[model samples]
Target: MKRIALTVSAILLLFATAEPKQKKAQPKKQEATSVQQEAMKVLMSGFSTDPRFTWKTQQDEAQRICSQYPSMEAMPAQAIQKVIQLSQADLRYPQWGIFWGDWREGKKIVENPRGGRFASYGFSDSPTDKGGNCYACHLIEKGMPGGTMGPNLYQYGKRWNITKENMNTQEALERVKAVYNIIYNSWSAFPCSSMPRFGHNGALSPEDVMNIVTYLLHPDSPVNK
Candidate 1:
């Protein structure tokens, strides 16, 4: 028993005096930097720009600003306002004097899923391969399977007080312009919106945007009905 106790004491003493294993600190930011560089290199090697479609590989001023902040709430009011101002400066009004378009055509554009990231260079060369595909992000009609990425715009016109009954009124014109502005550059209205800048990026033409507006605001349109 005495010998066993002595052996145990010696073992305990050895353990108490033993050098502790040091945990190596991981340089997380450095590792992240290396991974990001590798990813960029891979992307650059794979993508080639063509006349019809080009990838926006480089970050723009607004994108850079937005990336630095996690969310719009985290961003400064001044910065948000600056994004709005910059976006508004790029706004292009419709060539036609009237903002309205045929809602029927608008419905076609909303449902069509052609020109977008999928239509980029080497994927499609058709000029008519572009459309709004608004239904992908909004529930604009009843019983239609739509993505829930954006808010339900089922009664957009009615909620906004836009109707065929109010079409010729001055209020309708102003509301039409407001919707036009949103479709043109959502960042103008919401500095860090997930919505695309359809008009600003030339993804959708002025006429195309007007058509979408008609689908949303027309009284007889499914969105309003």
Candidate 2:
């Protein structure tokens, strides 16, 4: 309870002083620092690890901030800065230069929900035990199905100027970067997003994410078609 109190205190303090709308230029004026202690305190207070699975350790710097300052409405300016810096620095990119794959397969990944990590899963789930679970957060397809935690992604390809011809062009690489950051660091994109850090954990592999990117950019894919 005391730990929670301290955390809650920090949250309140940060909020009591931060000016939200005026933060348009926040990124241009922030410094880097570690928020590990604060994050650990919050995690230990709210998380319990069963014998089967383990409480994920906060490794990435952005995670440390998210774990601690779970509420953006209460995140300190300094902490937010740290989170952005870490996310931008550690974005995981694909190795084979294959950012796009079969969008058909990607759609399946985003819809799956049976592979979340749990303590009863033996400390760690299999590497392949991941899901894009995008539908849980965004209005993806036009009339198919999806969740509303994220904005609609139906015309994502069109919004990004993706077409049958340029879906595989150099422009595709830039799109991949944007998508990667969105998955790995939602806060980096939207300071108060409720989206989970899919890449920060084992929820989605770089390969898996590439497929989703393809789903959004591939011309023949339903998103573009």
Q: How far is candidate 1 from the true structure (C-alpha RMSD, Å)?
A: 15.2
Q: What TM-score does prediction 2 earn?
A: 0.66
List model 1 lDDT by residue over 1-225, tens digit each: 787567545533432223121123356445545655665565556557663434467656776566556579988888898899888898887778556788888887788876343333446635467777777788889888898998998978888887657887887888888888898889989887988888877677778778888888888898777
Cα RMSD of all models vs. native, in order, equals 15.2, 8.0
Q: Which ten residues in a row have the lowest lDDT in candidate 2?
A: 28-37
Question: What would the per-residue lDDT of candidate 2 be over residues 89-157, giving only the tens digit for each residue?
Answer: 656767776567778777777777743443124455554455666777788777867787678888787
Candidate 2, after superposition: displacement of residue 108 in Å? 1.1
The window of 10 residues in a row where model 1 has the poorest summed lDDT is 15-24
All candidates: TM-score:
0.76, 0.66
